[model samples]
Target: MARVKKKIRQEQLIEKVKNKPFLTDEELAKQLDVSVQTIRLDRLELGIPELRGRIRKMAENAQNKVKAIQSNEVVGELIDLELGHSGISLLKITEDMVFGKTQIAKGHFMFSQADSLAMAIVDAPMAVTGVANVKYKVPVHVGEKLIAKAEIVKVRGNKYFIWVKTHNETQEVFRAKFIVVSWGEK
Candidate 1:
């Protein structure tokens, strides 16, 4: 990683954004060995929007085909959805989501995201997490974007077996197997 120097880093930042627009300011700062403020300044000078802006723009352009749950009820911004099959969502870790000292995000947030994604993919009026076998593969820090992908493995009566994996880019951070029950099912 090149230490981003004054004036020189702007060009590099532009290239970086072009290659990976999903990178947050904190991530860019880490890659360039600069402060987050410096990255933000460089991004601003380069005429690049923040990560949230990029995500929102992408989300708007990419239509969600099937929405089993209310959009607001989803744990993260639903990027794609195919009812009764699979779905994808993205969540950005923020200050409130992490521990004050550790800077590591709370496990519940990850679980909630995965669980909600799993429930949202089910073809039902209402879905609830019945039991979850969860695993945390890595410590997720604040400012990281977690992408949760959920797929239904099988359906046994009213219980749906779902698998969710949350990742930070290519690295797996969390995974869960959930047994979800639809309220419509008896």
Candidate 2:
């Protein structure tokens, strides 16, 4: 019975990590109701790399595909990307990113994350946001991690319409629609 339960737990661990590769061992332990050491051991037995290695592998895959902006210029870490189609980025709000008193993150940081993601998805050598319609759904506090996903909706001539949604761990915190103009290979 113990072996059976261990097998089941290992399967759950694998599924959770497969779906959300960025989850740290601590987070995985919490979600699985297991100790972090157990999680690490399972990961080792399963041949799964640690969170940082997983993220680095993902970033390396997307780095070569980005064309509109330099990898370093992205407001957040670009974890997943498919040029001209969609992409995902992760940004963690820190002390310097939030207001000292309220602890609410500066709005521009969220906007930049979404905007830069929108620009990065354009299938051009270069792209710029000509217009942006955005809404801040809720205030995000420091220590919260934001996951922003961008999708290109339509294209007309040089203009690409992109929609980006930013979410904290719980719910959506921000969204934006952008009109990006692409420049032919620079």
Candidate 3:
């Protein structure tokens, strides 16, 4: 069999995202007709962190609420909470929620949504990320609303471990465990 041509380079993918009004790994993958993982790998090789990560970094640097709020890209509202320890966020996944071909929104999107809520509960000025492990259970289609409930599972020293469960239309669809480090004047 003859040899096949190589795919596009990482730089090319970055350029594509930079040119698009709304850049996402999934959208990029769909446009390129490649797998989401492929796009992730390309981003990694090019030293481009995930969108959520970038947003977190920006939030950390902001000096005021306006700048900080601008860092949030997820769409949702805080329904219930218990300040300074744990809380829950409710969100609806619409057609616009889709980042790529995946129906359940990007992993980073969920992570960010949960992270922001966790931060709010802690009432911290800035938080640093430590670790996160997420499991996708079902596909979240367009028009399906989801509720992501997160709570502080454990706190050791300055590290806070948060557990998040996502429900879609009365069904559990995703779950995640995150470790966050908060730095603020006490």
Candidate 4:
């Protein structure tokens, strides 16, 4: 059997927190039992940027600062636009996007990308992810570009079922079904 070799530095760290909650550099370093500098180095090499403004945008868009308060630091941006039932977004995965030495790209990052796009399409004051059924089809690599395409598949009262697909350049990388709950002053 051939061992799968990691092709990027971020991949090493991403493997550490695939399905887990997001963590800060200090927190991740401590959890992995490594030095902060080591974690920083890994992040720098993997092109993972800081996620400082991410929560702010989500808060502003959601119109609910309290709900947008995020405890993690994986940053992604909305690089595409569409409205009503469908939209697209692009997120640049950085070193902070990983966990240890595996390049799976943290699941939350992908989830956020999809969720945010869904919110954008819904054009509601606030949107929340109620549930999600996601499947990882291929491993995402460092320096690889990711694109998320989302569409509302169904809607019931405050709940909406959205379908999202994430891709890297040429292949479909991740797919998810998101159940989002949006609220506003009706």
- Tens digits of per-residue lDDT for model 3 on 1-186? 111222445556777765542357887788777799988887787777787664344334331332112334323655445544555556766666677656656655566677676565554556766888888888677777677777887888778888888887658888888787877664
Give the worst 10-residue stretch by lDDT in candidate 3: 62-71
- Kindly report which residue stretches of model 4 are placed more than 4 angstroms away from their true locations once superposed: 1-75
Query: All models: lDDT?
Result: 0.83, 0.92, 0.64, 0.64
TM-score of 4: 0.56
Root-mean-square deviation of every model: 8.0, 3.0, 15.5, 15.1
Error of 2 at 173 (Å): 0.7
Q: Which residue window of length 10 is worst by lDDT in model 4?
A: 65-74
lDDT of 1 by residue, 27-113 (tens): 899998889998887778777889988767656643354445666677878776667898788999999999888999999999889
Candidates 1 and 4, the one with greater lDDT: 1
CA displacement after TM-score superposition, residue 50 of candidate 2 (Å): 1.7
Task: Give the best candidate by TM-score.
Answer: 2
Task: For candidate 4, write residues 37-107 as lDDT tens digits.
Answer: 87777767765544444333433443322232231221354433334456556687777786576866787
Model 3's C-alpha root-mean-square deviation from the true structure amounts to 15.5
The superposed Cα distance between candidate 4 and the true structure at residue 146, in angstroms, equals 0.4
What's the CA error at residue 185 for candidate 3, in Å? 1.2
